[model samples]
Target: MSRPPRHDEATLLDAAVRLAAAGGPAAVTMSAVARESGAPNGSVYHRFPQRSALLAELWLRTLGEFHDACLPVFAEHAEPHLAAGAAARQVVAWSRAHRERAVVLLHGVEAFGRAEWPAAQLRRERQAARRVRQAVTGLAERLGAETPLDLDRVSLAVVGLPLAVVRRHLHAGTPLPGHAEELAERGAIDLLRGGGS
Candidate 1:
């Protein structure tokens, strides 16, 4: 009997991510991933039934990676407000470091309406968003101030900020540098300290 070839789901995912990062999410398809990974199309489909599934997995994995990168920043600071600032800084830094993946993640959100993602995934996305919004509001309150922070509005804005930053860089096909976190932190601090007008 012949032994079957070993296949790594992670190895296949990395290829999909690289393709999406290079030429936008459109570049990622089962065929493209199989070609990139030097794997058979049957092998790829055996793992992810459709391109959407692969893309969804890639999105979550990349987003989770970026979130993990900020965990230490959150842990290191005792003050909730300062920690938020620090988190923002680290997030922006991560966005800069992972520009291509960041763009893929950002554009994924916009393409979402068109993609018609799985309902379960959309709900999970909403829930994860709620957690982040709660954290921000909690930080503001803990810092001895109240925030008129509408989680819906702020969460959407905060999530989209990285996209704006990333698009400016990618579309220009050049370096675009700015400290968005500083602006966000200062704005946040001012609002929490003096309530939003």
Candidate 2:
């Protein structure tokens, strides 16, 4: 008998993401992932012991990827406002390039039952949270207290505004407008320049 090709964890996770994107979290069963990926049910189960594990892994992995993409932008721009603009641009650019993953992120962890995730996965979530907090704190420190910027306002300009811009398209299942990145960049910069008023 011929053996089935082994599908790696990424392939399986990719399938899961597609399923979630297409039909929401309810559609992401192991069998559905196996069917979507053209892998056997056993293969899906082999990588993810249960649905919760799969969901947790997918959510965490997606967040990790987004955070990873943005981390370098801070270092790339020494100025806090420039860095904020970079972050806003990154949010739009990343979402445009990876709409499916972006949808999952917009839906957030609660959709994937994050509260019930296993202990280890919860730890992973906490670590990701720390990285995000650290990035924000570092940026705030660089901006300095004398500056008009504060963590709350900077966050709104860099993260909140960009997310709001993308969330509309993702929720509607529409392609982001061609001007999305430019608009996001301008909005972030203008907000910061205006002292976030």
Best by lDDT: 2
- lDDT values of the candidates? 0.64, 0.86
lDDT of 2 at 36: 90
Q: TM-score, each model?
A: 0.73, 0.92
Q: Clashing pairs in model 2?
A: none
Encode model 1's per-residue lDDT on 2-55: one tens digit a residue.
Answer: 775665788888887788777777888899999999999999999887776777
lDDT of 2: 0.86
Error of 2 at 154 (Å): 1.2
